[model samples]
Target: MTRLLFAALLAAIPLTAPAAPSDPYPSTYAPVPSPPVLIRNATVLTGSGERLDNADVLMQDGKIAAVGAGLTAPANAQVIDGTGRWVTPGIIDVHSHLGVYPSPGVNAHNDGNEMTSPTTPEVWAEHSITPQDPGFGTALAGGVTTMQLLPGSANLIGGRGVTVRNVYANTYQGMKFPGAPWGVKMACGENPKRVYGGKGSAPSTRMGNVAGYRADFIAAQDYMRAWDKYNAGDKKGDPPSRDLAKETLMGVLKGEILVHIHCYRADEMAIMLDLAKEFGFRISAFHHGVEAYKIADRLAAEGVCGALWADWWGFKMESLDGIQENIALVDRPEKGCAIVHSDSSEGIQRLNQEAAKVMGNARRVNIDIPPERAIRWLTQNPARALGIGDRTGTLAPGKMADVVLWNGTPFSVYAKAEKVFMDGALMYDRGDKSRQPVSDFMLGQEAAP
Candidate 1:
């Protein structure tokens, strides 16, 4: 649906206030605004299933001006020589934990999990985000232009995740991606059960998990109705006393916020889908969906994305059925929304390589996956999942000039992102000491961040 119609629909639902509330923490994402530039004579992967050998990509005022062969450089546009290099949209990691669980992992840094309860939608990942986390620069150096910082899976509802531009800043808001819809992070399987069950808590089993979600969503539905009556002018008194947690839940039900769940098993994922149907909400993506191959058609039918790792398997009981061919199998159908995600800090650095691995795995299974098509697992697909497809994720005209220059074929093991741009501004240059970013936390510990 168009954003206008969606907004009108959102307005129809009873909200605590406006759907787009003044961000208590607003983004400080001011573009440095690079000059118009012409990147010529490169192998361009446009993220639209088209590869152009010896192409020219033009950028003007931080947006793609044009992309094709023999594109003329506008007046005084800086010309970038891209001979023998590969240019594509900067890689986007849909799942990440760069800030909340920053580098130099320590018990003191364990802020990802809010284990006080199975549901804590009142919390937000941005509040706990430490912008000085060196991991941001590391991922940026690896060509990650955008990512979402999600809450860990310890809770049945682990607060909200923040989508961000991979920029180094002093505050989390400074790094927040502009106009990105927030997502609620929820989980279905072992994590919630184990954590609460270990404490002799309520959700000691999978059944308990389902019951908890139902109870909470039911409460939210009732809450919405109450305010809805008031907003409709039939009710008497002022608005119902605000419930931060319930407010977020209502947002999901009203389609104001996206639902990104961490689910592994196919049975549990199906159950989650049923729960979403029951509550009248949408499940955007199933993070770490190891067994999604079993229900790939169901997910595609529902237009839900499966944000999964390329080959992560067997670390836990829920993940035992995972296969390296999981992504390949899910991507087999033309309708499937197969995504390559990294739940780990280390893995986020090379999401391109991870997608490449999935492409290779698919080819080995006699499935011919072309580079242009496979690159979507790293770019436009993730953007579409994140609800930012119109702005970034491709080299299309008027999209953000978030481009990456690879030293070799991006799918090859020997490849490296020699240059990375965000909004046409040079952010990371492997050959230049001046352009690389270094976070405050790593000022003394590490030299090149």
Candidate 2:
């Protein structure tokens, strides 16, 4: 053939066919419809380190329309008198196990882990989530509009975690946060070593745990190379057999999925960061990191967040050195990304109080964190950790109108979320009994929340 004809034929032929799409279990979450609303004369914590007093927030089309002092309300808006009320972006919990380990706490409800293997990245937490969990309702009562449901840390790599809008739905996919990135659950130090050690597995020691992670990533690297070669049409063969675990790990290697590690010790966290460096992947956040205070500067420098508890510690050796001011210390460093996460079902319902504990302790130590700055721990910081920072965390114009109207300052023990809005739709109201969402599991119970 002529040179022009040969080039034309080459262009006409397709390069190669790709494997199946990465996300099989995708989000089906759609925001509830809402009318225009104007909450005026309120103290607003924008979740972006800005506090606006006597200001108004206008929402239209399920987004923040405006936020400022003396803003004119739309003619068709439902104006809420925010006298003496505090407004904030809806609380976002970076770590929660609500749906996976649903309430009623029976062995049958215990589905947060697939401990049969030390590395089971193939299994997703959403597959095991029970959308009827009553804890989600209680969390809404506490102003949690979004949360990440994670698997248990009983292995080296637990599985994929799913971020969900805290909305009532029959299916887990209905609650999945739209466009949220997937997170892989990893554990360092004790949990992995202990769980597998008792059963006499490969990862019986801390070093063994590290080895397990390295071995898996090495396999993931090879798997990634095979797929790359096939996709580039450099090799002439069908695509390599798909390994679900390696697919997830390869997503991490390719920077598609975020990495959330359940690590307590500062040393273990450092080691995990080094491991990520070795494998050329990123560590998004360290969940339940009790020793995060010891290396706050390092975490800040690396742009990794610490999703931590306010005071819970000392239940085990790895978490023994935890302090009441752990969260505060983590937030002390400049550019630090510190988040207050609720690992407990009960704790999820009191995330504001959890943040309050950190603020109170911080004040005692003279490291004052104002309401504007502290709100980020429960809102902006968690949103960023879950890779949804640009969407729902802040009260900026054009962002999702997920908001809470508290009867008092949220940090005060007496404060209560009087009204909660998700996507500008009123999801919960303390005054209206009908607006109080009760899960089907709690419908007939005498002590229903």
How well does each candidate superpose onto the true structure, as a TM-score?
0.94, 0.94
**Worst window of 10 by summed lDDT in candidate 1:** 1-10
Off by over 4 Å in 1: 1-22, 234-236, 446-449
Off by over 4 Å in 2: 1-21, 234-236
**lDDT: worst 10-residue window of model 2:** 1-10
Q: Summarize candidate 1's per-residue lDDT along 319-399 as a digit string, tens digits.
A: 999988888877745677788999889988888889889888878889888888888888888898889999998899999
Give per-model CA RMSD.
Answer: 7.0, 10.1
Write model 2 residue lDDT over 134-197, tens digit each, in one string. 8998899999999999999998999999999888776887788877889999998888888889
